[model samples]
Target: MGTDISRPEHPPLARRHAWSLAAYRHMLRKRLTGQPAADLKSIADKRWDIAPGEITVSPPAIYLPGQMERVTGWEGQRFYPYVHPGPTMAGGLSIEQGPTRGYLIKNVWLIDGALYKGNASHWLTLKPQRFAPVLVENEIERGAIYCTQNGNSWFGTWLMEDCVTYALACDEGVPVTSAPSARYPLFTQAPPYEDWLGMNPLRLRTAFFHQLVLFDDVSHNRSRHQRYRAMGDKLLTHVEHAPHPGVFILRGHEGDLRLLRNELEVAEHMCVKWGFRVINPLRLDVPTIIAACAGARVVMGVEGSQLVHGVNVLQPGGTVFTLQPPNRFISYYKYMTDRDGQHFAFVVGTPDGDGFTIDINEVERTMDLLPKH
Candidate 1:
């Protein structure tokens, strides 16, 4: 969006193929259902149990920069059994922002000096920061771990901002049930709105170190990234096969859909000309993908959720090229990669209907300036 001289100028496409496909889907849905499903119908069938006082455990409090007494009243004490609620919905239980992090307890969210509490069923009063044993449940062993399921959503938000809280919970040394002996249940039974890597929370649980750690967008802090990187390095051992030194060009989505116009073609061109390895991250298992990212010197891809991998895996000072959609201006990855000590650059492209096209000449120019692999 800014007048950056390095930005690409792409020629507009003659046919809006992506737009046509979207329109067709809309029309077909309207014909079949008379209206589009709004308000999280996707998770209608999937249900979660929020059994309070299941097992009381006293986990240590996670402190932030500006908090006086540890913010502990309603938080550290209780462990939710299977608390899986999708993002805020009208009239539904909208999660309040906690002072320290995202949703941890119902109705109560911690800030700085004071704690904010909401209603009865969805409400509870704030108490003076105190420590007491509370119920906790590891959602992974129960059924599946809840996570945002969208490829085009903010990568750093999903991983660094949200998922880090889950990691924090595990680090508290709360007792958790073992992994399922049979087939693992999908995190959510619903079909994914966007492509995502199928990950088992069991692996994440194993990767966790039982230490009290508070995280707020760890990807933004170099020191925090080091800790996060340690976890990723541990997870890398699970990958049976991985390249030692590589440059990964992440392909967004899997199978048919793509986030950017001509992304596959662009990835192929880069691989042929610059010896970059094109990877569809969703195609590989979680551990393999993590290993590829951890070992890579450079990660290139259209701005999307897949870049979250860069936060956990890329070495400090690694380089990332975030090809942004020209019509849609987003700064999430730019700030995240920068905070993680990664040299970040953006190349804005021309929008072609729903997706956008990147200029090959601009890509080549940027590649020439980057350190040779």
Candidate 2:
């Protein structure tokens, strides 16, 4: 259930120097309990020297998916277009702006995010991984809108796109993030930090100021990245559209059952030959799985992370189908369903060991190439 994510993406340098010496001995044991650390020669700061191209962050971190998007799952299985995120899986520290004062380590070093210094970029979550451990105090707090919750907090629209859309774009004030500090805008899962480290006092908290975005860079930019299309038009005004609902997203028995096996015979063969409606966005509750994938035209799933609530509500021209498993072929939700124009398919499946097996006659010849409106 670990390692071998297709292996060799190059994680060696004595295992990245033992994960940066266990995150620099956990900040030298948080400076022997007093917890101060951050000197790194007092951050010379060339506006925090970032390099290795295409940099222009800010705004829910900035989405990133380009290259004539349209990626299928089978064939020789290879599609490459979006580039420049390779300085070591798009190398480190790139908060282009943040709770800037510094030091927010996790999974240890190259000095993780909110770094008022350098490392260069790639926290923008959703399967890209790593980037949630704050402490950036370039002193902003005036209007007070800090937010932290990088990614994979086990979904609920990823805490409604990393930390409940910046306190749902807070205004009444004090909607902070970074550590289990100022919460309340709640989204459950992955922020217990051991019950907020036993009822408060450290998940790192410090954010001088922040409002970043990285719902995998707004699911790879485009769809008018208006903070995830105004967070998918405010979750479709509390959802209630459903018509040609062919939901089908079931990775049931949750967490790592990605070992699909016969996922209940592929959810009873998509409700007896594609009438479909097998939900299970981890047993509902994200507003009842956003009203069962609201107004769906066809949502289908299997790529994982619960098809991010069918890329924030299917509808619009519909079709976000995905069933990949050629050992994890992944298509970052085809950069937000090809910038919300929709219709992004996939069918691979056939590895079976660490899980894989879907072909239902290529899922009915890919639902007979859908789009028949």
Candidate 3:
């Protein structure tokens, strides 16, 4: 597990500035008359006895441009979810991807207006942010809100992916947050059919933060896969469209954090050589994105949440290539592909100026490795 978050090189200047602004936001949020829990497990309103407390999973295979043998996941050790709330879990859920720009993490569970417990994870090195709940400006009186980190990033890609699977405990949750008493529009106006990979559709009833948030996370227990492929089936059924046999997803609006320095060069290679249909996710709305990806057999991109578009649309015989940044190597997409029926490959690249560059040779090598269709 050479997997570590610390970078040998500094992030681009834009990221540093954004992170500084987030520091101020964290300072303000910390002043909120709220509380945080020291540990998440202590406040569980309910727990799943059937769910395994611990399980081992084979790590996703990661490739580098030069190596014949592939390396493995982030933080190479097999990670287990410290706890599991079980399926269709409905409770308070809040997540802060980082101390910057978005939300702040709060650990204390609120019983009444001011009553609280637990501790929020540290922003940097001390405690990790993954298990902590996000602190919002207000709380939802009713309904379950959706808050997910989309980068498949260091930004803490939390459990909404889990909501796609474990949330399958229920296909339809009443959208009551819109009622007079309930006040959050929530993430899903309808089931975010575009985001589903398989499992019953996640019917979100709330947003912001909820007094009771309904969400789930199995990234810790990633071996349990099947529901994801099921959700993909549902998405495909709804899409009823087709696309290029090969696809390449770009990290459109995600900014230049791990920008591929020679992305255009690589994109041309993928397009001309592999005949991959290129997709810039930010440019298209969800429906359009789904239409472009509905029947795509291969999805490739810089390792990030945008890949989910093509990853969800893939069938039994498909391939997903992740151009992983050396500093951030997450197998999140691999978990979705594995056991669910798709070939997943990654090429770790050499660092370029602000971003990194992928080798055309590595691209060709990986293309050769893809299970021939």
lDDT of 1 by residue, 193-253 (tens): 1123222233211111111122222223333444456555655555443433345556565
For each candidate in the order shown, give its overall lDDT on alpha carbons.
Answer: 0.40, 0.44, 0.46
Q: TM-score of model 2 relative to the true fold?
A: 0.30
| Reference-based lDDT, residue 133, model 3 | 29
Score residue 352 of candidate 1 by CA lDDT. Answer: 73
Q: Higher lDDT: candidate 2 or 3? A: 3
- 1 or 2, which is superior by lDDT? 2
- Lowest summed lDDT window (length 10), candidate 1: 82-91
Clashes of each: 8, 12, 26
User: Could you give candidate 3's per-residue lDDT for residues 237-300 as a string of tens digits?
Assistant: 7666765667888884374476888887887788999787787866666677777877777778
TM-score of 3: 0.58
Query: What TM-score would every model get versus the actual structure?
Result: 0.48, 0.30, 0.58
Whole-model alpha-carbon lDDT for candidate 2: 0.44
Root-mean-square deviation (CA) per prediction: 21.1, 20.2, 14.2
**Model 3 ranges off by over 4 Å:** 1-41, 50-216, 219-224, 242-244, 252-256
Pick the TM-score winner.
3
Clashing pairs in 1: 77-134, 79-135, 79-136, 99-110, 99-111, 118-123, 119-123, 120-123
